[model samples]
Target: MTDAHEDHWAAPVAAAALDARVRVPGSKSITNRAYVLAALAGAPTRVRVPLDSRDTRLMLGALASLGARSEETADGFLVHPLGAGGSSHGEPVEVTLGNAGTVARFTPALAALGDSPVLFDGDEAIRRRPIGPLLTALRRLGVRIDDGAGPGRGAPPFTVHGDGGVRGGTVELDSSASSQFLSALLLAGPAFDRGVTVRLVGDAPPSEPHIAMTLDMLHRFGATVEREGAEFHVAPAKLSCPEYVVEPDLSTAAPFVAAAVAAGGTVRVTGWPSTTTQPGDWLRGFLPALGASVRLDEDGLVVTGGSSIPGVDLDLHEVGELTPVVAALLCFADGPSVISGVAHLRGHETDRITALATELSALGADVAETDDGLRITPAPLHGGVFHTYDDHRLVMAAAVLGLRVPGIYVENPATVGKTFPAFVETWTGMLGTGR
Candidate 1:
């Protein structure tokens, strides 16, 4: 566990080549999705080896608020489904979303199935992220919502009044800002009176893999979802999963994989799934363009550093969450790199593109923010403070930069607890720097 009082972390520099094996925990995405599905299931579901990070803890609390209790077992959690019509005892409920986007977006529609009022609020950053589009769609589906931000300008600190059911039907949504907007409705669709059909009205949402993941999980839980181009139709069905085993989080494995590229050596991540809907799986294809040899075998995904790191042009709109760590790796490239099609990242935990540009430039890299992405040019970098902007991915990026750049201090390293509580220990241990 990271010390809560520690303000800054002296990121360790690799003294020699690294040849290490790392075992990452369960996926935050899968863990939270399992929590939601279990809560909506017909019976108790066992979520085995779920991620026990802050985001998942918040999801557990959110489910508890909705009257879906859970019991901790020796290996995982056994979740009880919410009662029929998802009704809580006729009293008002308050949910704390914290800074988890999964909780902020996914819980509202779940709350709409109840017969009481559920108040949704979050941290300061959540108040700035986009939630208006989903709220509007929910309202169109006849779910009563009280958000002071009128029309298309909704944020946190809102109330949902559920009259025991949702009159769900076809609704148009502009999910370009975040794919979660579409997923939020789909997850809760099966419980709706008429189910839900979502049509994409604007730019296609980033993170297409997440939507696929949602559909896959929905199917696993007995819900039938249909897809036609940019539209999705989810049919009403009872959800039930006797057991769900979460896979390792590939996104969290990014920085560790980049460590091989930054400090010449080899790194292997165990339990790499043969098939996954995770956007992080895209790393296997793109890392080679940066002069890294990546191979997936029976052992796992192994990455070996190349003699030289070359830059390449790439579009990452479909996998925007990988931007921070990829951007950090590019800072050490032999040539300039252009990462395009991820403008939606601005609406994330923080303005990730702007934060990356600012912090990378602070460390002497020539980073310029483009309309949709970033242009990073290699430069003589020195050690400096890398502010994380309360985003966990940013911490991983800082750790990658610290591999070669000495004196790279990370601010509020504890923020990584949002997804990986053992990030510091695991990272330092890989370099033989941990106690």
Candidate 2:
């Protein structure tokens, strides 16, 4: 793995067509969700092939602070659940979120189930993300949080004073900024004394698929969740899972699949789930629209480049995490492409819409930022530096651009460690540039 603190990395340009088969690591989403569910499970649960990235590590660390320990196993991990009512210790514990959205939004609810006063803090960028709505919902559900940021200001560097139980009930929340707010409460709902009923108001949250993934995992863990329109009710129950197998991360596979499109070749990602709630699965549908041929066969999901990359109009709200790489691909399109319905990206690891517009524009692509997304037009491109703003997805996007455009230097390439720790090596290996 490249050192995340490295100054810059010269992204490798593909000299020939790619015919690579990529085996991405397990999903960070499933890994952390399993960690939280396992910690809340009634028995020790074995998580097989869980992702071993910085975000997952932060989750493990966070769970440990709440008195749940994970024993590393040959295949994955055996998570020991927290004691009833969580740790009885009255002392304070600290959790470092490290700019991970899952850890930042999900861990607080788990902290509310404990007796300790847990202080939640993370990287400077995390402090700027929108977590206040989730925190406010927690307060409504009877969890006391002190950030000194006042009402409606629920950024990190906050303290959750847990009295060992949550008075979970119906709480209205506006999850427009992030679906994590809803998933956070739902993940910990089974452990709540009265369970939780989340009534989402205002605009429907982007990434409805993520909420479905959460519900699916909850069901696998023996929790009963009922959804009625915009309201979801998670019944309080003892959760248990003997073992859970994680699927390969499709989001991480995006760049490699996109490389086939950019460099005019074929790329196959192994272990592609036949059916999944993963938002990355949306790629199979959208890639073809961008003039790529997609097929899911026994080998895996194969993507073959088309004759000419064409511009597309796409609404990526459900799969907004894909914007970075998709935007990168669009930069090489034959015509103009407009991406819409992902304004929520402003609150991600960075302001992705702005970041995409700025960085891609810097690389000579005609890019414009919209209220919710970006409009990208193809132009004669020459790359100098692509600033990643410490966002992992940006690194993947830059790599795709590098496949077609030479001399693309990625800044802080190590930041890809946020999810795909081996991103640099894997990407270079796909292009036959790795030592």
lDDT of every model, 2 decimals: 0.91, 0.91
lDDT of 1 by residue, 42-153 (tens): 8999999989999999999998888798999988899999873245567999999999999999999988888889999989999999989999999999999998744634
Candidate 2 per-residue lDDT, tens place, 128-191, comes to 9999889889999999999894474689899999888899999999999999999999999999
Clashing pairs in 2: 4-414
Of candidate 1, the 10-residue stretch with the lowest lDDT total is: 1-10
Query: Which portions of model 1 miss their true places by more than 4 Å?
Result: 1-6, 84-88, 149-153, 433-435
Candidate 1 has an lDDT of: 0.91
